[model samples]
Target: MTTNYKTSFLLPHDYEIPTFNYPQYVLPPVPYNYQPYTQDIWSANVIQPLKTKITAPAQCKFDENKYLNLFSGEFNECYYDFEIDLKEIDPTIQSISKFQDAYKTIEISNLNNLQIKCATPYIENFINDRNVNLTYGNDNCEFDDGLLSNITLKKEGISQTDDINFENTITLYTNNIKVNDIETKYAIAYTNGLPSGDYSNDYITKTKSNVDFLLQVTKLSNNDNDKIKETYLQVYYTNDVKLKIRFSKVLVAKLIRMFGYLYWGNDKNIVIDINNSDTLGIKNNSDDPVKIKIKPR
Candidate 1:
């Protein structure tokens, strides 16, 4: 079955089909105030998906003559924030030369007892102690330049076999040294990168092959006299793993039905797992009964 197409499905619906491979990551938990370290030289850039506000067309029964009756309160309207999937992007890299004019500097607190990992290539004479004081980028060089000699550096060239690509990893580290009573910790990953000549921080191209879904709660339907009192969505996956569906925006929906298109096939049961969410509770929120659509893009 094709796995790169757009299709729509109704929630509270059921289907059975073969399962295919999808990307999975075991994310590490971070503190609320924690920020990731960042540099500009690495090719591993984070992609931010774009979002376009969409108003779903009315799907319930409405007056045919007035056309104004579409807004006559026959149906409840719900707005949802949606995102574009990264799978649709054409992957490419910005040339290394693009960052030649840029430099990233990070302050290392507790420098006396910490190790650091730097991503850029080393220039032998970038730092010299010939002058009493020196400066490079944002950091002031007060300690003797000889301190760099204590750093442990390693390099691994890119590997390819039979014209096929293999794992390519580059890393650097340093030994803890004290200078001017300042302590330095290692540089980790960061959320932003230096300005790109061809790319912007607003959007990102995929660096990995994993596919991600951008879903939105689009339309809510209430056709019965009894309102749906309490409603929440549960997403199920392989091995019965599930997650409660929540949107970034505040949305009011009942039996919500999301509508959108996908590039993949509609025959797969895993595609509709979001529809058959396990019941969160037996309690109903609204006395009115409606069907809400959960659309995935």
Candidate 2:
């Protein structure tokens, strides 16, 4: 067995095919550096230096107060001194002279000084002279003189006084009315088909007329006599084509009225109170077990 190993056959070698080597793709350089740029480069080098070197156009300032005071007088100075003895002075002549002096002394420098010192820039100036007749002066002159000949002074107190008095009187009168004297009327209507249990499904119908719907009334008194009142009503019904079906907890109560009375007698007028809760109940099924309780007023 050691000498018989010489008869061997040569077999074809299975070799793997070589793949194509694609060149490594290099990315193009970015236009900007990837690293974050610092603020010193943007502010000092780009923005601040340019801003510091550029000079802006100067803005012209026009002092309104200065202009007005220069043309007028001291800010708070009254146009006319009532305390001054004018009995010996003719008002017409004095007014004429004041007008002349005002027209002559219309300068901006004086106006500016007056504006600087006065709280209000609306200053007035006047000069007095004899032998000239004066009918009336300007607005500022009138204001300074406290002579509201042309202007209508609003009497806020007087206008409000009547309203206050009327409100009080009406309120007092309303405090005496009774609750039951206030009456309200409402009309309601609905159609109901008969239940299948009662008759054949031939659409039997029933209607109720002027049913004495009961209402409950409550009186809320602010004082012993001034009473606010509320009225409530409850209603119920149901729809049945075959057997009567009761709606699931679908009932609503509504307040009909919150009223105030002007008098406590039988003929008293009722004023509706805007603030109160009133409710009414609606039942969709007549056969459904429902209870309506009308409490005494």
| C-alpha local distance difference test of each model | 0.19, 0.16
Model 2: lowest-lDDT 10 consecutive positions: 158-167
lDDT of 1: 0.19
Across 26-134, the per-residue lDDT of candidate 2 in tens digits comes to: 9998753222111111111110100001111111212323221111111111110001121112233233223222222111110000000001100010111111211
Maximum-lDDT candidate: 1
Clash counts for the predictions, in order: 41, 27
Where does candidate 1 have its weakest 10-residue lDDT segment? 158-167
Candidate 2, after superposition: displacement of residue 65 in Å?
13
RMSD of 2: 42.2
> Which predicted model would earn the best TM-score?
1
Estimate the TM-score for candidate 2: 0.10
* TM per prediction: 0.12, 0.10
What local lDDT does model 2 show for residue 141? 17
